[model samples]
Target: MALKKKKSKKMTSTGTDVNITSLMDVLTVLLFFLIKSATVSSLELTPPKGMKLPTAEMKEEPKEAIKIALSKDMLVVDEKTMVKLDAGRFPASYLMEDGRTIKPLKEFLVQEYQKKKDFYKDVADENVDLLPPPTLLIQADHKLPFGTLKHLLHTAAISGFADYQFVVETPGE
Candidate 1:
């Protein structure tokens, strides 16, 4: 009877291919996370109670901006109630001498404009024209009087917000 012994081999390094697919997948996930985190949303807009938004055929998507919502008995700015309405209208005490100026709304908008300035101050320093334009998103009851809207617009203009977007619901939704 005879027995055979196996020969020992020395371990050595060999060229190996990198798994670029897995690496790319991890990088893709990280990129998506960073992109999502870096974006700052203005606010979530849920239709206030007792308010019906008008429907429209939207041509473009709305961007991030300050929101001015007029509910049944309140005026809201970015979800914060700025003025409590009286019978769906602003209280007399909330108006200025001009009668069209919404005192509380104007004040809150001015403060918000200042905040936007500070937030984009660095950008302004780089290029004065690069600063984001002050914009407002107006959400109001469909039955609101045109006069009230006019006053709201005037107040927003005086408060330094020059651009506006009227919020609306689309058909079938």
Candidate 2:
């Protein structure tokens, strides 16, 4: 019997191939840019003393806003303050337990809105090269009564503060 030898076929000429180092560098730069942009988009919220915030599932962050602080006894909107019903002192008009009186939040919100608008106008002019439109930021206490929150919401809506960013805690953190 005669033995037959098998021949091997060559697949390529030289081992030199395309260099991917530049491609890898570009990808790394792109990744870093994306990470930085994502961080710049979210907003942070901090509650006041003795006040906790509720949580939400939405992750959107609004830029530029007026902050509203809701405490157990008071409601604060950028230096403007109002005492809650339990405090026995009403600012304007509020419904009493007897339903004879009322402490409305309209005036306060209107005043605040005007103040903010003027301030923004001045600042916007000074920094024509920069600055953006304003938005509303609500940082109500978690334990705050629903009535206070509802009234504030209404006031804000009426005052042209339609855009709102409700500050809250992140779950499981």
For candidate 2, write residues 17-51 as lDDT tens digits.
99999999999999998886655545455566777
In model 2, pairs of residues that clash are: 65-135, 93-102, 93-103, 93-104, 94-101, 94-102, 94-103, 95-102
Residue 16, candidate 2: alpha-carbon lDDT = 81
Worst 10 residues of 2 by lDDT: 95-104
lDDT of 2: 0.63
lDDT of 1 by residue, 41-151 (tens): 555777788889988887456777887888658888878888888876778899999999999888888898777777677655655346667889899999898776877
In model 1, the runs with Cα more than 4 Å from the true position are 1-43, 126-130
Evaluated at residue 49, the lDDT of candidate 1 is 81
TM-score of 1: 0.68
In order of listing, the candidates' clash counts read 0, 8
